[model samples]
Target: RLAGSAAGWGFQFQSPGFVVAVCWLLFLMGLNLLGVFEVSAGRLGQVQTGSGRGGDMMTGLLAVIVATPCTAPFMGVAIAGALGGSPVMGVLVFLSMGLGLAFPYILVAGVPGVASRMPKPGAWMGILKQVLAFPLFATCVWLLWVAAIQRGVTFVALTAGGVVLLGFAGWIYGVGQRRSMLEGGRGTVAFCRVVAALCVVICGAALAQGLRAAPAPVVAGAVEAGVEPFSEARLAELRAQGKPVFIDMTASWCITCMVNERVALDVPSVQEAFRSRGIVFLKGDWTNRNAAIAEFLKAHGRDGVPFYMYYAPHQDGVVLPQILTPGIVISTIGK
Candidate 1:
């Protein structure tokens, strides 16, 4: 869906942090398979339990989200083509990508013989569970890196610490579970469920708040002090004045876009080149998913962002590459 929208609507594809998160997840899963960590059968052992179901569902969701950051080589061309086509066409392309991702999991889970051949619940399971925690730890590290890019190291540390504490609490709870607790009365089980739900809700809220409080990243070398974002009307007016305009359409969730701005766009030479060429720089914020921006993307055949469009005086508009380079920008403007 994202790739299709990006191509059709000219949105940029920026997802390095996502890529790291996915790689870490795969690494952790691999470690579990290799018997690096053990899974435990405890009071919360029943796969049918609400908590177990919730955990499994959450894991599945995280897998999907993490996988989205890195486009496999085979998927790149299809995604690019979707972004440059009609909305329906773009959506179809995304659907194909989704199917490709889900197929392996479905096959593994559906085949009864294959599922039975998998390691039975045992001591190794406990070790596998502990090893799985390492991936979550790695994920925290990656999130911290991304947070450091936007906010400071302090905020990153705080967020990472909080996430670690949450994990530690979960580990303690899991390890403390006794067989007696599993055989306890219905009332006792109900109470435990309530407590677990409350804890999960609290942890979720804290994480959301931490992410919200993180500061916006500053585009390096750009004098952002009082430069207001450009409206569509303002862009049209500038075009009327025969000035070249560079539009950066981005969102807070876009890690790749942020990196591009800080590392490439913010370079002194890039900034100077834009200024010297009398280029009007405009930033279109898509943090909250504005309807106008959505329409803008749909017009270009996109459904999501990190989109970049360049309009030059007396020339055809140019769609910038998804992966940015200083030379790409300089050359585009120079033309």
Candidate 2:
């Protein structure tokens, strides 16, 4: 929050490289869960450390970083408050949030006999572990979709190729592990692992180059009919004309934004209401890091996407809830 505030709160969003890196991590994690490879006490899936304390600390840090994006929309209010207030207040809010996040784990750890109550090891456990890989795979697909929206098809192709290479590396590494277990051909096992590591490095380097390439042009008027691309000047013009306007500040990577649009904004009833009521729907795409959109979010005391504002004719804009229902939209416009 402090870093974001220092940069005018626009840098709160992740970069294209960060998204691609996370997608790769999720892909590799899925492969690990699917029995493609084992890290053998390495810091990937089912991570192991010689010292339990270091492992626990690293795992906690990793959890916080990964979970932040998923929880940002819901935590916007508190985050905004933290950013807008004093440094002490900001620290308190974050400290409170961390405590809240750790509470469930603390509860589980503190309780006696919790592990004893868990079902004994069985075939079902293996099946469940494999089944869990699908969600990781799905999340990787979603991130790639977000990448497509941000950079274009070429970016996705590059990322997809990287994913394939990662899979190949995993397979090769797994083969080496199996051979080494039989206690023969140690030299061949070492050679296989070296080759697998090289493949991973090559994939990472290629992806880095792809991300550094220029993004595709943002085509105007490509959105759904009746929705206009948002611009500050356009907003001012509409407001000057005493027209009602709804500003949707969203990003492709924002899960809550997608959910709200699907459940409320994209519905027939809401579309009809928008047409009949003559509301100007202006959408700001923050899929890529945009300074203008960042400024707009900052003006509204927000540091993240999924921000919604409604401007009634001749009135100040009214901020809406993070979660929206069709009824909420219809009623907000009807008034």
Best by TM-score: 2
Kindly list the per-residue Cα lDDT of model 1 for residues 253-335, writing each as its tens digit: 45566777887688998899987988888887654435666677666645555667889996767887667889988888888
State each model's CA lDDT, in order.
Answer: 0.59, 0.80
TM-score of each: 0.58, 0.90
Report the lDDT tens digits of candidate 2 across residue range 214-322: 8876442257889999999999999999999999988777788889999999999999998898899999987766678888998888987788999999999998888
Residue 155 lDDT in model 1?
52
Question: Which 10-residue span in candidate 2 carries the lowest summed lDDT?
Answer: 4-13
Model 1: runs farther than 4 Å from truth? 1-60, 67-92, 102-165, 178-194, 201-228
Q: What lDDT is obtained when candidate 1 is compared to the true structure?
A: 0.59
Off by over 4 Å in 2: 1-14, 40-50, 86-88, 113-117, 218-221
Residue pairs with backbone overlap in model 2: none
Give me the displacement of residue 206 in model 1, in angstroms: 7.6
